[model samples]
Target: MAVAQLVAGQNITIPGDRAYCFSVQIADWQWGVIVSRQNGSLSLLDAIEGASISDDRLLLNLSDIPEDIEKLTVYIAAGVNNTGNRTANSSIAPTAGMSARLSDLVDAKEYASIDISQQLTGQLAVSLIEVYRRNGAWKIRCILQGYREGLSKLLESFGFTRDSYAAAVASISTSASTIATASAVNREQTDTQAPVNQEAGDASITLVWKSGQGSLRSAARYFMGKNFKPVSDLRIGCFYELENGQRGMVYSFDASLEGSFDGVPYIKASRAQNQHFEQLLINARFRHKLNRFLIFASMMDAHDSWGGLNVDVEFQLPGVAAQTLSPTTLMVKPIYAVAMINFNDEQTKMTPLDEYFQDLAEMDRAFAWGLPWQCENNSDNEDQT
Candidate 1:
């Protein structure tokens, strides 16, 4: 066995079957050992575990690597905080040293050892060394390189370009953003459509529908409140009929058109295109101030499927009359609903859409309309209102 202290761009050799080990003291920082092919693309040693951090040291078993691989790189990086911030150990004194120990594991003998130190502040990461086989000899080289910007720049020097890294990071960010956006939209909708007090002189009335046991089309005549949130690629609409036999819908997809009932001007819906659920406002009040209006809500779930859904309608007289109608529970389906009258504050009771429709039909109170059905291409009706 031979011992040598080498710096950047040096070389060494080992028998192809000889087991070799590289150990480095990285102190409190995080380090990783990566395998690289001759073409510069990296391999994570998936076939055999080639690297790990043990007792604050990065250990790599070069003997386990496939013969096709030509190079191995070692690096030190910033640690993460509880908040997931990757700024820990981002700064070090000018004298901070990174040292490595190489050994012939099969012979139990030392081969080479080297220490490369740096002098810098606000430095986030560094690539420490590269070991490669040349002409049947294993050669180890010290990088002693530092990056003020962090691991990203250091990785780039190993052939992982910024654009490629950015693309991977963007993909992960988009997935996370989708989940977070849905949760945020749901919370905002719930807060905005909190149940109002009908007993209060200024209280408003509300009605709710839950798409119970059926498809989306059966719930088409119904609509979701503007306050409801959509996860992604969805549209919500409300259907209404007045005493004067006028019928129209207020929908998120269209601007309130110029239309009226009983010549009193009715059905004003905001016109919008590809709306963000957090910003829409659903209004149900008839312009004519009709004594009674029959209405329901529906959703179009486009791009994705959802499980929990319900709708609410708030009603109030032109002056002081106020009341609420809602279901006790939500529905698994995205369309076709069971309507219920909720008279109590903090109401939690839910009725199935099928049962509600059955009771209304038996009592001759159910209006005649096609059952709302589900459509995979248009499943955005959310009625948490």
Candidate 2:
């Protein structure tokens, strides 16, 4: 059968019963191909560096895809190599002379082809095509949309939060010469570092902090006053900003939104139980996309005070000694901005804020976060005089 040539926005129906192959051929070794599920739970299906292409082409079997995956997207980005170097400038686009084709795996007969060479520009990434299931039939559509901001922007547009984007980039960067399959990428993303175990003896043990591995936990411990009544309103939160200006706040009331990225809670919050301590955790990998992190404490009820709440916050990183911070005594304030962590290409620095605020608006203004505050009344404080 004669191959059908398709243009941008055009589509062709595909057979679902027989196995088919989708292949991408590019001229430059700096470009790489990435396949992801487009319909449900956007995820990376495979990533292959151009330099590692077997026959100057990256191929995918459409038949082996999962049943739940109704749609698949094919994307190309720059600097996908085995060296783990993702240093390509966002303004630099992949070289021209790239084409994609779909063919039957058994007969090796081409069904459809599209040349994307003429659409090249100053984009760091581009969406080439999509294979989707509709009415029990598979179809191919030419996308050819380019992202000038590169892979991160493309990923963000596909529902990737700051944490998930960072994790995906890490996976793409560390991809081996062969294609990194979907299962492998998922496994790497879900793998968590084993917690360190301590023995009862005073044995001298050396702690090793593996670079780019593990999580950072921020915890607050406190005690009740002479009356032995717990500070029920005492809570801890974290406000974070990404390099792309995306921002969010995670606290006791909003803990469910903490792990909105790929179902992995990058920042988690736990309320004080039995008048013990409140805690928050930050996945270290998320630091890759985070510009700043602000850790704060607040009392939901405006009438509540920190007078008898001797609270202390601790910052812990794997293999490193934990650092604790005790804020100045505040008897009337309901909110306190405790610390700020700044991330950059060189290093990360955590600075103590230790400033009391009358409300979250004041804290937002202090940091120029520009967040729209939504204050709610505490029902339990209705009987307060």
Candidate 3:
């Protein structure tokens, strides 16, 4: 006894490849009935022709519904029908629940015809669905998928390996450990502290936090679409390693995220405290401490023949002797996308990211700067150390 409400701009893609329903809801979840848009009325049809670039938004036209309709809890998303996976919305609300970008989807028809050897070739990422709002908001959803099998094929040609990808993440710090601390200085430097841990191999440290608050966001599948939900200051990945070797993730800064259609450039949006915190973080990561390595990793560019990315993690080492990261100056972690592609390749073509890393390097560096990660990105920290 449940009825699904429909809206004017609402777009509902039927389960099968058959018909697309627009401008109408069933008479109380009554299967197969939809109000049509052509005649300014309601009508049931076996199938309707659909276009890739069309109205994806489901506008709830209350005037078109029957008088008996009760409980008008319409399900209207900021989008329209897509050719396949990821469609673009014209009037997307800043905080709408789910909005897909056309760039994230590979017109299967176009994909089947392209290959790594082909020019202007790229892969598809399950274009994340964002709920936008007027306040300029975007949030992730649980059901969204990033890169799928079809998109994986495209990335594979570039050295993305069937199960691999090229990924770069940039982390910026303020002057010093200031944003979250009362004693934090806004200048571009912090008191020169000793490099905490500098050893040849694996070493752990007591990651001290200015306070016990603040949440950190991660771009991994594990951290997707969690911001919109009720989250606390604890457990957003912002860690605080205490003297006793215990660590806790805190929710410290207000964060907003925005990305380009291509997925290459994403920004941690939000002007208030979030941006300030970001500037501070970036400054510390690059300018005073280990900023250069962080920049390289964040702006490196994503490619198919993506050799696993190298993270030049330069955080405050509270104790270890500051020696060059000899033996291995940086930690290289293969992107999850590339790894997935590698696995898919074994099942499909049978190659690896490690093998094609060299071949794809030239192509990757071509448009690296076009990405969000800039060449030299950092802000002025207060502590001028």
Candidate 4:
């Protein structure tokens, strides 16, 4: 039979009588394959060090698989510096000319092949395909969903706890050796380039809000009558935790947290007021020492709610498109947890919460921030931005 060329979201049935092998071939050493079972079991197959093609393969025999095992998922994860670290940032991309194939062992013929070089962007991980038992027959589906949050988040989706994920990564790192040649060449090119004003290591967060108009005109009018200043007096705050477990917050009243980790400012909130927006510039180079960075928006007036404004938060990182969260419809409460940026030694991930809260204390408890909420006070003297 002619080999079927599969596209994203395509699927094919596998003959249960014959044994097959799933193989992944890449042009460089930056990518690896992961096989996950339905029972929360995971197996990592790292690509050969400094090799353009992977020697690892997963043999599939439907008859040998237990009846209780309903499904198996294969994932392609981007590696960092060939360190067995599956954490990837937006700067990471697939090496050119990568492909995966399923072949029949009996005739040495390919049953299905997928050219994986297309439809991939800055994602760190991609679910390449899935093998599952459907109607008592083995079937495979091409699922090219990208995980921008990287391998850690993908592992979390497979029911990996923080400690277990750390252990898994540690095991993977034991065999990691030299960096891929492509990554090395890219790094050299980056190093030789002239420095720009906005370094690739820096990131920024911006918050913008406007009074809802059109159908919300009556609601805006009611808010104005109730003295709810959503745009003018809106405040954006960040709760952060350092590597040493020390926690701090930066907001309108606090304005900034400078020299917290080193001499560099970790996060600084701009006091400069704009009619429509507030900005917070973050020094991402210090991310190595940062553990948690949570952002939230709150109303200074306890009586005021966020019902009449359209709130938007944008997170900007270098070399990637800006990720924006518009939670205007979800902002019915006085406090809304906007997002949280998780930074570890491997990668950085941003998760949007968009959850409403009654107060800062409630938000803190929900995230288990353990921040000292006693210092939080509603101050009218603070400048709005």
Q: Could you say which candidate leads in TM-score? A: 2
Best of the candidates, lDDT: 4
Ranking the candidates on lDDT from highest down gives 4, 2, 1, 3
Summarize candidate 4's per-residue lDDT along 21-82 as a digit string, tens digits. 67787554234445455565765533211111223455554554556565667777766433
Note the Cα lDDT for every prediction shown: 0.44, 0.54, 0.20, 0.60
Angstrom error at residue 314, model 4: 0.8
Q: Which stretch of 10 consecutive residues in model 3 shows the poorest summed lDDT?
A: 108-117
lDDT of 3 at 293: 12
Separate clash counts for every candidate: 54, 0, 74, 0
Residues 45-66, candidate 3: write the lDDT tens digits: 2212221111231222122233
Error of 4 at 42 (Å): 57
What digit string (tens of lDDT, one per residue) describes model 2 on residues 84-139?
23465422655566788887543457999988776667767787888777877778
Candidate 2: list runs displaced more than 4 Å: 1-231, 260-265, 301-307, 318-321, 375-385
- Report the CA-based lDDT of candidate 3 relative to the real structure: 0.20
The C-alpha TM-scores of every prediction are: 0.37, 0.40, 0.18, 0.40
Model 1 regions lying over 4 Å from their true place: 44-63, 80-89, 93-97, 106-108, 118-123, 161-385
**What does the lDDT read for residue 35 in candidate 4?**
46
Cα-lDDT of candidate 1 = 0.44
Error of 3 at 118 (Å): 38
